[model samples]
Target: MSINTNQFPADGNISGLPDVTELEKLANELFSLLPNEMPKANFSPDLADHPRLEKSLNLVHDRLPSLFSKGEGFNLNNPQTSLPDPHFPVNKTPQSGFGVSPPAVRPGNELSLNRPVSPNSITTNTDYPGLDHKQPSVAGSGISPSAAHQGNAVNLEDPQTSFPDPNVGSSVGLGHVPHSVAGSGISPSVIQNGPGYAEAFPFSPDTPFEPDFNKLWSSINTFKSTPQIPEIPGTGGAQYYFLQGAGFKGNDPFGINQNPTSQLSGKTFSHIQNGAGHAPFDVNLIKKDFPILQERVNGRPLIWLDNAATTQKPKSVIDRITYFYEHENSNIHRAAHELAARATDAYESARSKVQVFLNAGSVNEIIFVRGATEAINLVAKTWGEQNLNAGDEIIVSNLEHHANIVPWQQLAAKKGLKLRVIPVDDDGQILLDEYAKLLNPKTKLVSFTQVSNALGTVTPAKQIVEMAHQAGAKVLVDGAQSVSHLRSDVRALNCDWFVFSGHKVFGPTGIGVLYGKEDLLNETQPWQGGGNMIQDVTFEHTKFHDAPNRFEAGTGNIADAVGLGAAIDYVNKIGIDVIHQYEHYLLVYATNLMKDIPGLRLIGTAPDKASVLSFVFEGYKTEEVGAALNNEGIAVRSGHHCAQPILRRFGVETTVRPSLAFYNTCSDVDILVETLYRLRGAHR
Candidate 1:
C-alpha cells in the first residue's frame, strides 16, 4: 500500500488512514509468524505442532476464536476511557506527552532543522501527542478482530491486548520506519546497515517482513550446500526471518551451526538472501573460537548475556596478547631494538585498525587511552577547557551513560557553563524535536551515546551530529556500547570525536580509542605530557609531538593494543554485518519468548534498538530475577547499569538486562526463556 504522507494534517493528526484490508492482512500475518511452538533440537517441519509454546504465549493474552479489542478498552480504540489490565499496573497520572511529527514536505532540495519548524509542520509536543509514560499490561479484549486490526491511533500494548506495536512506543502516536525496507522483503543488506532510524513506525518496517519465497527448499538439511542469509530481525517475531531461502530448512539443531566463522567465506552479502554463493553463519563454529564459552557454570553451560558490561575474549585475541608478551614485548618508540620495532609496529597497527574500523581520516587522529572514561576526560580537559567559555552550554541526551554525562557535568561546573539535556519519549528514544529546541547560539558542544548501554537504544547518531554541526557546535559520540553491536562509521557520523573501550569490543580491558577529525585534532592541544610525547625539552618550554603521539603521555597498554588489532581482524574475518544480523536474531527470539510472562515490563521498546532487553517483573525485585537467571547458568545485569537518569526517567531504579553478542545462539535464548518461565510458575 503506497501511503501519501501529505494527506496528514499540520498537527500530525493522521487523516485518510486508508487500506483497512491491507492493515488486517499485515496484523494477521504478524500473529501467524509468532512461534506457535518452539521446536526442539531435531525439530518438526510443521510450525503449528507446539501446544506448550502456544499456552506459554497465551499467559498474557485472553484466548478467543480470533483476538480483537473489547468494549470500553481498545485492542485498537480510543484511550480516554480504556480499561486497564489486572496483571500489570498502569501509571494513571498523565504528564506532558512527547511526540514528533513527520518531516514537512518541501519542494526544494535543501532542508535543515536549524530553522524553526514550519507552521505547516507537526511537532511532537504540539501535534498528535502520546499518552502517559508508563507501559500498560496486555489485558483481555472482547472486541471484533477486524475492528482491532484496523491499526488505529491506539496503544498496541493497551493493557488489554498482548500485541505489541513494531513501530510505536508503549502508547500510540505515529511515525514512519526507516525507508530502507522498500525492496526484497527481508534483505539483510539494507536492514543491517547502521542505525539512523527515525522514531515510531505504525506497522512492520517492511511492508511484508516475510521469509524468502523461491525454489529455496531443494537443499533441505544440506547445510553445506545452502547459502544462508542473516537478518536484522524485525520486532517480536524477528528470529523467524533467519529461515533459509523460501522455507524452513533442517539446519543447526543446537540453534548453532557447527561452523559459523566462514559466513563470508568468499562473496559479498550485497545479495544476502539469493544464496549469494557464500557460506552461512555458523554459531557453533564461532563458539569454538571463544574457549570461555566452554566453561560450565554451576555444572551448566555458561550462557553469557551481560555483554553490555564486557565481552568475552575469543582465543585469537588471547593468543595475540600472549604472542606479544613472548615475542614482541617492549616499550614503544623509546628504544631501537628488534622487540621495540615489533612493539611499535604492532601498537601502530592497532591504531591503524581502529582508524579503518571507524573509517577515520588518518591514524594520527586515533589516540589510545585507559578506556572510554579516560578518553572523555582527555576531551574535557583539552578541547572543552580550551574552547568552552563561561556562559556557554553543552547539550547531552537523557540517554547518555554516566561516563558521557559526568565528564561534561564536571567541565560545565568548572567553566561556569550551563549543561542542558535533550529529553526522551515513552520509548527510550531521544526526542529529535526536543533536541532541536535545546540548541542555541550558547551551545558549544553536544555529546551523547551512540547506543544506550542500559536500554539498547540505537540513537540517530548521524542525524544528531548533523544537527549539532548546523548549530555551530562540535559533537562527541560515546560509542562504548555501539561499536560492538553495529557498524559505526565516524566519517559518516561526522562527529568531532568518537570514543569506545577495547573490552567492550572483544579486546583488552585497559585499551580504548578516541578518534578525532584530522583538522580538529591538530587544532587542539594534548592533555598529557611525557617522555615520548616531547620533540625537545628545556627548562623554559618543550615542543610537543602531533595529536596521537602527544596524547600518549606515558607507557600505554602496548600488548593489549596488539590484541585489540587481532580482535578487529577476527571481527573483520566474520563480517560485522553478519554479527549484527545474528545478534538481532538472538534478541528477537528472546524478546518474543519473554513477552509471554504475565507481568514482565519491557523497559526499552524502541523500534530501532540494539541487542539489549531491559525489563522488570512484577512481585519480584530485579536482584531476585537476576539471581534466579544466574542459578540457571544465565548471566544478566540487575542494577542501575550506571545509567540512573534514563532508568529513573522510566520510573525504575533497576532492571534485569540481558544483552547479546554475535557468538550467542538461539539455544542460549531458549535456556533464558525457559528459566524465566520456571520463575514465573514458582511465583504463581
Candidate 2:
C-alpha cells in the first residue's frame, strides 16, 4: 500500500512521525550544502515514482538539523567518526558541485594519518563518496513494504522510474544517520534557520540541557588542594590523647609519665626513671611494643634483624602521623588559619627535638635533607666548591658507604684535587696510623662513616675529627649505620658535619637529619634555591636566609617528620642506655653462635663493633646463606653492602650481614644458628 500524502502537519511538532512536505524541506537544506552539478539523478538510478521510498527518504531528510547540533560530531554507526575530522578529504572530481581544489602531495612530507595535514593543501573531503544517492524501490533490496514501513533503509540498486532528489543524500539512502532523523525527515528551512538546530532533540518540548564545565573544574581543584585523611583507631570511649593515671600504671619506671600516657598533660616528661617499682628490664616487654614482632614468617615468628638497614616503627610513631593528618593538616609559613599554625608549630617542634637528639649546638645547625646522600652532596657542592682548588687533598675511608665516597670523588675530579683513601686492614678496621700519615696541611677535608654499613666496624669519630683538625681539615661523619645503635653527641665528637636517615632509627622514610657545626653551616652558601629557603626576593637580586632555611629549598615531608619526632619520643621513653646495652648483648650472643658454626667465616672482627655480624659459608655462597636464612623467617642482607673496596681489602668476595637492634632477642639468634647449620649440612 503506497500512499503519497504531501504537506507537513504545520503544528511545529512531529513527536512521532514526519509528513511528505517536511521531508522535502530537509532535502532542500541538504542539497544547498552541495553544488548544482551532482544531484541524486547522477548517483542513484531509480527514484521517480516509488512512493514508499520517497516517503522514507523524506523522513531521513527532515532529521538533518538534529544530527549536527551535538557539541562534538558523532557517527550514527561508526564510533571513530565522533571526533571532528579536519583532514577529511572532500571529493574534488570534475562532476562534484563544491569548488574545493584537488589535494596535492608535497615532496618532503609523508601522507599517513599520524602526520599533521599541511594547512597549505587545497582539497579536504569531510563527506564520503556517492553522498547524493537515493533508492527508488524498498522491495528489490529485501526491505519491507509500505511508506512508513520502508522507513530509512532503501536500496539504490534498482534502476526503474525515480525522482532524483540530491537533497535526500546518502543519509536517507543507507540509513547512516540516526533512525529518528532518517524516519522523520523535517523541513530544511526549520533546520537551517531555527533555535532547535543547536540542541540535542529538535522538536521536544522539554527544556535545554547543557554541561557546566566550570562547576566540574572547581570540584577537581578542591580535590587537588585537600590533604589525605589519616585513619584513627577507636579504643572504646578513649580520646586521641589519653593520660594514664596511677591506677593504669605500667611496669616501666616512667609508668604514668609515658608519651602515650602523658601526651594529654601540659608538659610531658622526657627523663626516664630507673626506680625499683618496675620489674627487671625485660627484652620481651620491648618486643611487644613493636607490632611486627608478632607477625609470622615461614612457619615461625619473624626475626627482623635488619635494623642497620632499617628499623620497624612502634605504635607511637604511627599514631603521631595519624594525629597530624586528622587534626593539624595544613601548609606551613603561609596559611593564617589555626590548623596551619599548629602544623608549623609541630614541624618546628620536631626540628628542635632533633637538635637535642643529635646534641647539635643549635636547631639552625640541623638541616633536614632528603637523606645522607643529599646531605653529603650539600657539603660537596657548598664546602667543596668554595674550599677545594687544584692539588688540594680530600681523604675518605675504605669503609665508607658509596653515599659517603661518591660525593667526595665527584668534588675531587671537578676541582682537580687529590683524593686520598685511609685503607682498612684484613679485619675490615680502618688503619688509623695510615689515616694519621695521610693528614697534611694540603688535606682540606676528611669524610668517613662512624660505623661501616657492610662490616659493622665502629670507627673512632672523635680521633678522626681531632686528627683532621690537626691538619686544619674539616671532618664529615656518615652516621647512617651508627645513630640507631649508639649515643651520638655531635658536640662531643666535634665533627664539622654528621648525617643520618630517619628510617634507620625506626622513624619515617624520606626524612633525615644533617647536623653541622653552627658556624660551618652559616658559612656554607645556599646550594639549591627555591620556596622555603628564600628571605626577601627581587627579579635582579635575592637575599637568602641563614643555614637551615637556606638548605631546605622545597616543601618537606611534614607527616614523616612528625613520625620521626614520635620515634625519638618513643626511644627516649625506652631509654637509649638500655637500647645500647640490649643490642650489645645480642651482638655478642650472635657472634658466639656464628663462631660455633663450622665453615662459617665471620668478617670484620673489629674489637669495637656495632651489632652487625657479617659472615660467609665455605660450601655455600653469601647469597645462598642469606636465602637459606630468609626461608627460615630470618631476614638479612647479602653482597657488597655498598662497601665493595672494604670487602675486597679483607681478601673476601662478599658476606651475609645480619645487623641487630635492641628489639632483636636471643631466640632470633638461635633461629639464625639453626638455619645456618641446616644449610651447611644440605650443601655439604
Q: Summarize candidate 2's per-residue lDDT along 1-684 as a digit string, tens digits.
A: 011112223332223433334444544444443334325342243433444344433543454333334212222122212222111222212112211112311111111222221212232322322233333333212222333133332221111111222212222133222111221222222322333332222222231211222211111111011121111234221121121111223322223323322321211111112232221233544565678888888887788977777899876677667757866787777788667776787787788878888988898998887788888998999988987899999999988888888888888888899889998877677899999999998999999999998888888789999999989999999998988878889999989999999998889889998889887878888899989888889999888888888888878888788677778876765556556655654565567557668898888877667888888789878888788888888989888887888888877778888999877766677678778877878877
Residue range 539-639, candidate 1, lDDT tens digits? 99999888888888889888888778878877765667767766765665566656666889889877677899999999899999999888888999999
lDDT of 2 at 628: 80
TM-score of each: 0.63, 0.60
TM for candidate 1 is 0.63
Off by over 4 Å in 1: 1-223, 227-278
Evaluated with lDDT, which candidate comes out highest? 1
How accurate locally is residue 360 in candidate 1, as Cα lDDT from 0 to 100?
92
Find the candidate with the highest TM-score and give its number. Answer: 1
lDDT score, candidate 1, position 57? 34
* Stretch of 10 with least lDDT, candidate 2: 217-226
